[model samples]
Target: MSKKRYILSVALIILTLNPIFSQNSPKTEILLVGFDHLGQMDNGTPSSDIFSPKKQKEIIKLTEKLRTFSPDQIMVEKEPSEQKQVDSLYKAYRENTLKLSEIEYGSSETYQIGFRLAKMLNLETVYGIDHYESTSQSLLSSGKNIDIFKNGLLELMNTARPMKKKVQQDSLSIYDYIKTINQPKFIDLSHNLIFNLPAYVINGKFSENGTNTVDIGKIDEKYIGAEYITLFYNRNLKIYSNILNAQLDHNSKRIFLIMGQLHIGVLKDLLEANPNYKIITTSEYLN
Candidate 1:
């Protein structure tokens, strides 16, 4: 019990507590909610009336569940180029000085979902991370390929687009509808509608499903199939880039992003690969 024993005991105590003090912080938390654009869905069918009393109740319920997440930043599918415009609109909305109908974006998910959630969380800024890219393609021949493409579109018309043809008349609430789209099956359906469809047909036969990676084929035949798929990936890739840029090294532990359901499949893979993020889903909250 001399000086040497006392020094050894002190060293052991310091070493044992170092790990507790210096442990790495957990990775950033991200929740990607693939919310259908409510306003746009009112096109063909006669539903998705967000302003309706019933739908408003559902929206309130949905946001109540999302409120638990209390995200520091809310990212929307709108383009980042409109940051100043969005900031102004959001500020007005937060201040209760703006009526959504007064603005063109009121019907957009950027307002219905993004603005609503940001307002609920009492957040100051909503980030727009969407990207646009030019694309060109079409069906030119009649064959099994055309049949497949038509069938895919039909399936989407029936299944993928939410709140269609009297959704209000039906029983499903907006909360439940949003929950359904966040599921993996719904995300896969969206991906298949685009990539798995027979987008490029040369002759009576069609290219294999998901053959977006084009090879150097005959000079006369352009790889329309690959180009079509590439366009989807390209736009989503740019959106991913925008998300990273939007993050701005802020200390946001949880970030909520609202995008088209189609984006979930691709962005999930991209964000999962990054070591700095830990991806979460609505399944935990919505269910």
Candidate 2:
């Protein structure tokens, strides 16, 4: 009788601990791809000058690998309007609106890659953010120059701005960063790549004369680099939280988010939110 009781007690203890442990540990596979650029159009081929063809091929191969898990949903960094445009096309599979062949150069690559994967896997893609048109329309209504703002942002990212490294105490949260930077007024801040560089560049190239570092006036590269790094760290925290919440809200079993490398850096925070999913990357499963 004592022996039976001991086994029963152990079983009870495990049952109790299981729930707690399960809550603390979740498993979700997050495959993060760092694309060459975030331009508005959809390009079939990635720029070898910017990111190598080898890397681009690897990304596609990784996309194929994702099919094995069979993701039910995909979240993109594009605005709602753009997302809708693509979603509509995918639903119809063909429309006069835009041809898959029409997508070329920098802007087109994102859609091509995303839709290709979606079609191959038959997953629903969700444009997880507010529409750019809504934001642009609001800005226009306020008599703000949307063109200037857009141009400024494009210039900031493309022009060689020297980034320096330094720890900043400001809130690292994406919401806080956007608020602190007053990003609504700045159109460029809307995109993830411009805002989240630190997380994406895993093997960060030392750029003394790169377009990304063009804006540092007289300030040493160290400070500029630090500012850029801080920006991404905070942005990643905010975005990861958003993605986690979205996944929970939708009650999705498998979700694959294609964002910059930087945002996907916070895997632990992401896993904590969705504690029942397995977290893996293209690199991990592929090579």
Candidate 3:
């Protein structure tokens, strides 16, 4: 064989013999956009009205920017149980037959970011990947003397308050603001706030027994505060499972997830450990 033909023959043999090369597929590119809950997490502070003309214009620009990712699948913080209802709502929004703000929890970031961008991309549906079981609050209230490391948590929030105020004040456009919070620094800060709660341990550590009893102190061995925070973390883990199990096309290469800041850090940590995924940060495309 000629020199060129010999090299081509060698390459063909390698390609045919190497199962690794033959089986390789594009790594799924996932962008987890950490977002504010609009109002649910506002903690008595009302979020700026996203419904205003100025904010609406900013949202349009933000959606257009995210369109660059061309995600084959989009996930929201909503519960999977709401999937059917949200699909109908998304269809109504697409057909101009309904306004998201008219219904309950309609003005959530799921609609503002997930639904808005999905529609802009002309995608058929969005995925819901949240799991909510409200045991944290009850744990806090169940104990007779639940410390909650109250001072530490308070100090943490007080420190974060200024930055939170600036973001909520509309000092920056929606696009810029989302970019700001989704930064790795901010995501870490938001996540660490809850870890303080686990330090409020007393005697032995235990999770809820689901005995229909309110007083956990009666159990004799209870880690009220640790269990409180554990419940929150448990919910996030379930959310992670939902993301992994979401039904996407076999050929889908990109997934865009929009969820609250607290959940993002945990999810990012979980996703980065998986070799099948590549975590695309907000700074990448938004810039």
Q: 1-287 in candidate 2: lDDT tens per residue?
A: 69999999988778658843454544445544443233421133333221344434544664565567676767666654465675676665433355554554323334545666777876665545311211111111111233443454465445312210000111122122212222222222334333443233232223443333223334333333334444345545556656666666666666766654333435434564655666654444333
Against the reference, the lDDT scores of all candidates come to: 0.72, 0.45, 0.71
User: Candidate 3 — worst ten consecutive residues by lDDT sum?
Assistant: 210-219
User: Where is the poorest 10-residue window by lDDT in model 2?
Assistant: 162-171
Kindly list the per-residue Cα lDDT of model 1 for residues 1-287, writing each as its tens digit: 99999999998778556632223545678999887777765543344566767777777788778878889999997788988999999999889999777778586677877888898888887988988553322332344356666676678778854454445554677788889878888888777767766455334433343333334234223544544556678788899988877774556778998887778888988989876678987898898
What TM-score would candidate 1 get against the native?
Answer: 0.77
Task: Give all TM-scores, in the order shown.
Answer: 0.77, 0.46, 0.75
Best by TM-score: 1
The global Cα lDDT (0 to 1) of model 3 is 0.71
Q: Pull out the clashing pairs in model 3.
A: none
Candidate 1: residue pairs that collide = none
Q: Which stretches of candidate 1 lie over 4 Å from their true place?
A: 1-25, 43-48, 134-146, 161-163, 166-170, 196-222
